[model samples]
Each structure stands twice: as C-alpha cells, then as structure tokens.
Target: MKTKPLYLNDCYIHQFQADITEIGDDFIVLNETYFYSRGGGQPGDTGDIAGIVITDTKRDGDGKILHYFEGDCNLSSGQSVQCHIDWPRRYAHMRIHSASHIVEYFLFRHSDNQKFLSSFISGGKETSTYEVTAAITPEIVEKIQHDANAFIKGNHDILLYPDENNPDYRYCKIGDIVYPCGGTHPKNTSEIGEISIKVKGQAALGKQKIVTTLMP
Candidate 1:
C-alpha cells in the first residue's frame, strides 16, 4: 500500500487520522500519515499514535513507510489511529528549512558563486543548527543574518504550488526578488522571526560549513 505523506502537502498539519495497514517487528505501517519519515536532511517527525509514543519514523525500500513507537501499545492491523505531531519541533524545522533556503539564495546572489552545496538541519534541543555549504566567516555570517532578517522584515510572499510539475517546488519573493525551492517554509518571512548564522569554517580546501538558527 502507498503511504500518503500529508506533511509534504501541508507542513502545518499537526494531527491526522489514519488506518493501520501492517505491523512489523520493528515498526507499524499506516495507510496514510502526517508523520514525516526521516530523510532530506530534516529529521523524521515524532508524536503520538493512539496513545503510543511515536519515537521515530523512517521509510524503507518498496515505498513502505514505517512509524516506530517508543514502547509497545495495543495496536492491531485495520485498526483506526489518530496521529498527532510534536508541533513545536515541527515548527522549528519549518523555520529552519525556510531560513536555509534564504541563506542559500543570498549566498548565491551576493557571492555570484555557485557549485557550493550541502545543507541540512543538525544539532538538537534548545539549539538546533541549520548547516549549509559555505564558509562561515564572521563578516559573511553577519551579512547573511542581516539579509535574512531584512527579507523577513519585508514580509515577502512565500507561495506553495502543489501542481507545479515538481511537488517540492516553492517560490519566495520580496518585491522583485524571486527564487525557487523544494522544501517546507513559512507562509511569510515574518513567520521566521529572528535568525542567526555561524560559520563552521571551511570543511575541505574550499568547502565551508554554515550553521543557521532561529533565535529563541
């Protein structure tokens, strides 16, 4: 059975109702899910499914997605379940995801440089880190932080087009500035609030590591 990925279409969906299709030794498969399976640098979503603490989620080959519970719960195949997500954590990820794109856009625009890659959400709790491929000099970090804030302050539009051929495609703009993306983002830059960046120095000879965050 195909697992419906609800979060992909709506990041704000914190709860959903689904039916259990199969149960495995290590995980449970759902007919549909709001829980994000670990992938795309972003971590999998966590929450509760029918009073069961969903500790982690992952996808396997053959297109089957699994939801791993922290402890055993009385769940049976064909049974109905209500899945709820940890919104605070998911929201943080949403912001970081958007902020990462903003950083990438600015880095490309200002540096007039391309080919630099690598981006993901790292670190954890009270201090999540958004890492991107770019040297994190103090000056550059400051500039990126400033630019990201400015963009947020401008309250630019964040539009999501589900039928744009590429389901992951996203567009953001401030006046005339526009760019394409394929990850979850806030409805507007203002939703991002405050942002900061720290360069982890050059990863290799020329590769760099940049860590970003939303100020708490």
Candidate 2:
C-alpha cells in the first residue's frame, strides 16, 4: 500500500501516530508518516516509534517508506505506533535548507545566473553545501551573503504549496521568489536565524561549491 507523506503538507509535525502496514527485519512501513526520507540533498530523519529508536527513513523501489531501527522489533503488522522524529536535527535541516534557497537566489542574481548543480546537507548537521555550474568569486560571495541577510531580516513569510500544473510537484515561495522544491522548511525567513556562507572549494574544474551554516 502507498503511504501518505504527512510532512509534505506540514513541516512542523514532530510526532505522529500511525499503523504498521508491513514489517521487515529492522524496518517497518507505516500507513502514513511525517518522517522525511533521504532525498534531494537532505538526510533521512531519525526518530523513535513506540520507544524504538529509528535510525533512518527511506523509500523502497515500490515507493513504500521504510522506517529502519536497531534491535528486534516486538511489534507486528497492524500495530498502532507513536512516532517521534528527532526535532532538533529536523529543525536544523529545515533552517539550512531554507538558507540554501536564499543564498541561491542571491547567487543567481549576482553571478550571471549561475545554476545549482547539486546540494547536500551533512548528516553531522554542521553545514549545507550547494554546487553550482559556474565559478564563484570572493566578491560575488560577499555580495550574495549581504543580499541574503537583508532578505532574511525583511521577515518574509514562506509558503509551500502544490504547483498548479502538477500536484505531485511542490513550490517553495519566499516573498516573491518561487522555487521548485520538496524539502522541509520553516514558515518564515526570519526563523532561519543568522547564517554564515563560505566557499567550500570546487567540485570539478568548472563547478564551484559553497557552504552555508547556521550561527549559534
């Protein structure tokens, strides 16, 4: 059975209750889940289900969300489970993911429409990096950072909604700028807090990589 992804509509859901539809050696598939699977540069969510610690969340080839945990699960199919996600880690990712979008906007505007090739948020939760198709200079980086900070301080509200053309696809809109994304993010730009951006070296001869981190 296809599992409903609750987080697609609400990113702030830290805990939820669901029924187990399937069970494996170390993983369980829920009827519905708020846990985010590892994809689009964001790491999978780790949490606990009925006090059993979930170490990772992923989707199988058939599109079933597999919630993996350590140790033997004394649970069985059709059992009701109380799920709690690692809120701190999930929140950190939410902030960083939003920051990357802000930085990308500024970078594109200042750097001749430099395109993002890929992005990754570390499992360690220390930094989020985005690789672009073109080189990023020190001056460009400085300008992007300044513009991003000003944008954040403006306190723009964020909206995530389904694209009119495709309900399966989603858009992340911060103020006037809209980006196609499916990652979790805070409701407002100001919630991201202060961020620090730095160049993280090149991924290839022509690609530039930059890292963004949240400031304490």
Candidate 3:
C-alpha cells in the first residue's frame, strides 16, 4: 500500500502510530507514516519504531515509504507500532529548507532573474545548498545573505498548503512571496533564526552552488 504521508500536512508531528503493511530484510512499509521520505533535496528521516532504530526513510520505486531500520527485524506485517521521529533533526531540516527558500527569494531579487536550478539539505542542520544558473559573485551572495537575514528577522509567518487546483501539489508562502515546494518548513520565519550563506562551488558546467546554514 502507498504510505499516507502525515508530515506533508503537519511538520511538527514528531510521533505517530502506524500499522506495518510489508516487511523486508531491513525495511518495513507502513500503511501510513509520519516519516518524510528522502526526496526533493531533503534527506530522509531517521528515528525509532517500536524500540527499533530506523536508520533512514525512503520511497521505493513502487511508491511505498520504506522505513529502513538497524539490527534485526522481527516485526511482522499488520503489526501496529509506535513511531517517533528525531524532532531536533527534522526541525533542523525544516529551518534549513525554509531558509533556503528565503535565500532563493532574495537571490532572485538580486541575481537578475537567475533560475533556481536545484538544492539539497544535508543530514545535519549545519548546511544546505542551492544551485542557481548564474555565476553569483561574492557581492551578490553577500547581498542575498543580508536580505535573507532581514526577512528572517522579520519573523514573517509561513503557510504551507495544497494548491487550490491540485491537492497533491503544495506551496509555501511567506510574506508576499509564494514558492512551489513540498519539503517541510517551520511555521514562522523567526524559527529559522539567522542564516549565513556563501558560494559553495559549481554544481554543473553552468550552475553555481550556494550554501546556506543556520547561524549561531
């Protein structure tokens, strides 16, 4: 069965109950799950299920959310399990994901309509990256950082909801800017705190990789 993704609707849900539908050698597919499967530049979630350590969560080619766990697996299908996601880690991703959007918003305002090519959230809260189609000189990166921080400091409310026309799709709106996004995010910009940004490197022949991190 395709796992019902609970995280899409509520980013703050750290714990949930799910029924195991399928069990693999090291992974289990749930009838529903709160785990955010790895995709769209965000890393997979890791936590625990019935005292078992879930090493990672990912979607299979068949569209099942596979909860991969460490050590032995004695669980059976149709078994109900209590699950708990590592809140700090998931919250960190939310902050970084939201901060990345803020950075992209300002980057667009300064980069002369440069395209946001791609992005990635590392496993840790320390860093995330955005790939753009422009050279993105140091001056522009600095300007974007300043503006992004200003926007974060404004503590603007962020809303994530399904598209009016397509419930399967999602959008993230902060202030007056709206972005097409499906990743998790904090409820307010203030939760992201301050962020530091810099040019990481070239991701492709013509794409520049910019890195952003939550500031101390």
Candidate 4:
C-alpha cells in the first residue's frame, strides 16, 4: 500500500483524517499519514488513532506507514479515523535534528564537507553528536560554535522541495547550502535555540567526535 506522507508536505500538521488501508497483526496502515515513520536517523511518531493510543509507527515492506497501537487495538481496514501526532515529541525531534545540521554546516565549511563517521541523538531532548575526520583544534571548535549560533540567531530560512529529476528525494535549502534531506525542520533556524559544541579527543584513526548540546 502506498501511504501519502502528509508530514512531508507540512511538518507542522498535528492532526488529520484518513482511511484505514490495511491491518496487520500488530499494526494498521493508513491511506495517508502526517505521523512520521522512523527513517534517516530519526525516530518514528507516536500518537492516537480515533482515541485509541498508538505506541509507535513503522514502515511496512511495501513502504506503507504502520501505526502500532498500545495495550489495546481495535481498528480495522476501510474504517475512517482521525490521527493525532504527539506535537511536543515530534517537534523536539525536528528542533534537535535541525540544530545538529546547523552546527554541521559550519563544521563542513571549516573542513570542506568531510563525511561524518558516526552520529547519535540521545533521547529527544539531549545532546547530539557526530564524528568527523577533519582536524578539531580548540580555535576551530570555538569558531564553529560561534558561527552556528549566529546563524541560528539570524533565523535563516529553511526550505524543502523535491528533486526535479528524482521526486522521491527532497532537498533542504538554508542560505546557499542545499542538501538531500527528508527530516522535518523548523521554518527558520531561530527555533533551534543556542547550540554548544564540546570537542572530544580522537575517536578513531584520525576522526574526532564533537558533542553538541542544545542550550537555553
């Protein structure tokens, strides 16, 4: 079943209506969904389907988004239902994810777009880290943090549009930087708040991990 991802078009959509397309032993697929299913290092969405609590959502083999219910499950295919995504939780992921990239923008600028070896986001509201092979000096670290915060303060506009040649892939444009992304983000950088960077020692052969925390 092909599920229309309403969230892809509008991340701020918290509630919507849809019909049940299919039902599995543990999950139900919706005709359309604004609730994001886990992918791209982001967690899946949790919410309710017609007042029944939903614990998690995942993508099925055919790419249909699955909504998993909590202790009780009482939904069927072809049934009309209302969807409510946990706005606070979903918004946290968007903010934190955007902040990390905001910091990453400067990180790559200083190092000329090096590959991030490994990265992790702890919980939905904690420090996120990414490892890079670029040289991590004290002065460089300070500069990256400074520039990132400044950009956030500027509230630079962020854009999302599908690639003309390949519609399945979406690109996020921030200033002159454009990269392929499908993750939800704030309309502007101002929502990312202040970002703090902690330079860590060598994590591998020559790569270093930078710990990022969202500060008030």
Q: What is candidate 2's lDDT per residue for 136-183, written digit by digit as tens?
A: 878888898889989999999999999888987999999998999888
- Name the top TM-score candidate: 2
Worst 10 residues of 4 by lDDT: 122-131
lDDT of each: 0.70, 0.84, 0.83, 0.79
Off by over 4 Å in 3: 124-134, 202-205
Backbone clashes in model 4, listed as residue pairs: none
Report the C-alpha lDDT of model 1 over 54-165, residue by residue, as the tens digit. Answer: 7788888866789887556689999998889888887887777777777766766665433645456753212223334444467766887788788878877666555468
Q: Report the C-alpha displacement of residue 45, candidate 4, in angstroms.
A: 1.0
lDDT tens per residue, model 4, 102-178: 77778877766246665656444433344555557778779989998888888788888999999889988876667
Give the Cα error of residue 24 in candidate 1, in Å: 1.2
Candidate 1 clash total? 1
- Candidate 4, residue 100: Cα displacement in angstroms equals 1.7
Task: Score candidate 3 by lDDT.
Answer: 0.83
The TM-score measured for candidate 1 stands at: 0.82
Ranking by lDDT: 2, 3, 4, 1
Which of candidates 2 and 3 reaches a greater TM-score? 2
Cα lDDT of candidate 2 equals: 0.84
Each prediction's TM-score versus the true structure: 0.82, 0.92, 0.91, 0.88
Q: Which of candidates 3 and 4 reaches a greater lDDT? A: 3
